[model samples]
Target: MNQEHDAGPGRSGVSRRNFLGGGLVAAAVTPLLTGQAEAKAAAAPTVDGVAQVTVRAAVNGSPVTVRVDPRATLLDTLRERLDLKGTKKGCDRGQCGACTVHVDGRRVLSCLTLAATTTGREVTTIEGLADGDRLHPMQQAFVEHDGLQCGFCTPGQIMSAVAMVDDEGGADSDDEIRERMSGNICRCSAYPRIVDAIRDAQQVMR
Candidate 1:
């Protein structure tokens, strides 16, 4: 006849008052637990007696020195440590090129690249693609060509296209551009417009 005992078989019968109190306790504790975890992770983890490595690298044209867990990826350092969120974190396994960025002017998947490996290199994210108030040519071309939708993948797409043009000397043909840019996936299916933007930017870039 008790409401607390009416929760049915295979379950622990909890009173309404107890349930609410438990929820309140959990709500109060969760943030503290999360903050502790975040603080620990942000402190740069140690492994096998080795402390976090001090990496001095150039990011978006500025020099940065940070202690990073040797296992941390460049994507994490850029987004979490440096607060450059323009580099998207779409499939972190490198299947999605949304985290693509320029390392020494070559396009590389940031999520799969180790932060330690970039110690002496120049890393350019979407934030660095522009020159003070002016968008990079490829960025402008994408806008003019209507090359993006939803825009989640736009940064990576533009970065990849710019590097591709530099590497190949030109966009050449639509098919060639598609082949070279096959790594960056746009779920919006804006492939045609993206190709057009690349062609347009390549002329100006050249």
Candidate 2:
């Protein structure tokens, strides 16, 4: 005896293909809905509630003042507000030295430094490394030695090299220079050329 049992109208059996199709549809729609919600949230004005403060500092030998959020970092203020794009935003957590800059002649990670804390201090960026038509010796050496590949990390590497030379601690020896410059990461892995450039520039800088 063959008897067919009807699965109720609201409880129709789902085939494997139908189940997979339904899952795929749900997965595609989820991302679309998430993106739309994120876009809407991002479109909303956010400055209305955040506090901003004025920070005064000498940037690249020019006296300047800018208003920034209290939580804004020196790297953001330099790149966004002051239009100094040479200081790159990499890692943004101080792990990568791409945001390296000189504050009062000392190398510091700009991303970890608060913009407000730099008030009344001399902040030197990569743009200030050159003198009019003449590039800094370290910069020239970097170019001559082909010390960079992608060049995104060159500015920070050069800045840190200049400071290292000025500090007169590690520029003399390859091992020392490598140790000192380890903070600056060049994903291009141009280590040998970078060391050579620093050594060459150290001689000319002296």
Candidate 3:
């Protein structure tokens, strides 16, 4: 009787089956529980977080639609989303002119600009200024005059020059031109060539 009980038929197999069944039940239930949890999270209320706003602005001479974090600066949106990598981020603050772009034909520091606020305004960047292979006169002049070294600040410099030239900001004497354009600084100490480039380009534009 003891031997028969010790060799009990299919007892280990029955226990194994029970363990596997329990594991299967738990495995099936976990995903369902996770889905329920996610659904509950979805039902949670929205609160004080910043709202995303979609804006339409003329970027690189093309109309574009972008949805951006409301708090994101125009510079961040332009560089990150619009793929206008020419605008350098020298100082996130407005002190540096490296992030300048033509906003509605005027030079606006993109670093200080708000993307949502610039909707429907014409924003011109370095990439947009050229007509296909032909460079914008300022770009050509900058190259001819060697207006850059390291070239990190070249885009913003030229963009500012474009705005300056458009506004006849370069019409003044060299000192005044230098004074007005003084906001833009070149780390490479290329100011003299930059001024010459602007002067050279001014004559061509006139």
Off by over 4 Å in 2: 1-48, 168-170
Q: How much lDDT does candidate 2 score?
A: 0.75
Cα RMSD of all models vs. native, in order, equals 11.2, 15.8, 18.4
State every prediction's TM-score relative to the real structure: 0.76, 0.76, 0.75
The residue-by-residue lDDT of candidate 2 on 115-205, one tens digit each, is 8798899999999999998999999999999999999999999999999988645465899999999999999999899999999999988
Clashing pairs in 1: none
lDDT of 1 by residue, 102-162 (tens): 9999999999998878978999999998999999999999999999999999999988988
Q: In candidate 3, which residue ranges exceed 4 Å CA deviation?
A: 1-48
Among these predictions, the greatest TM-score belongs to 1
CA lDDT scores, all candidates in order: 0.77, 0.75, 0.71
Model 2's TM-score against the true structure: 0.76
Better of 2 and 3 by TM-score: 2
TM-score of 3: 0.75
Candidate 3 residue lDDT tens string, 1-206: 11122322244666422443211111111121122343343221211233445567778777676554455588877776666789988977887699989988999898888887988899988888899999989999999999999898888898888888886456467787788788798888999999999999988876
Q: What is the lDDT of candidate 3?
A: 0.71
lDDT of 2 at 206: 78
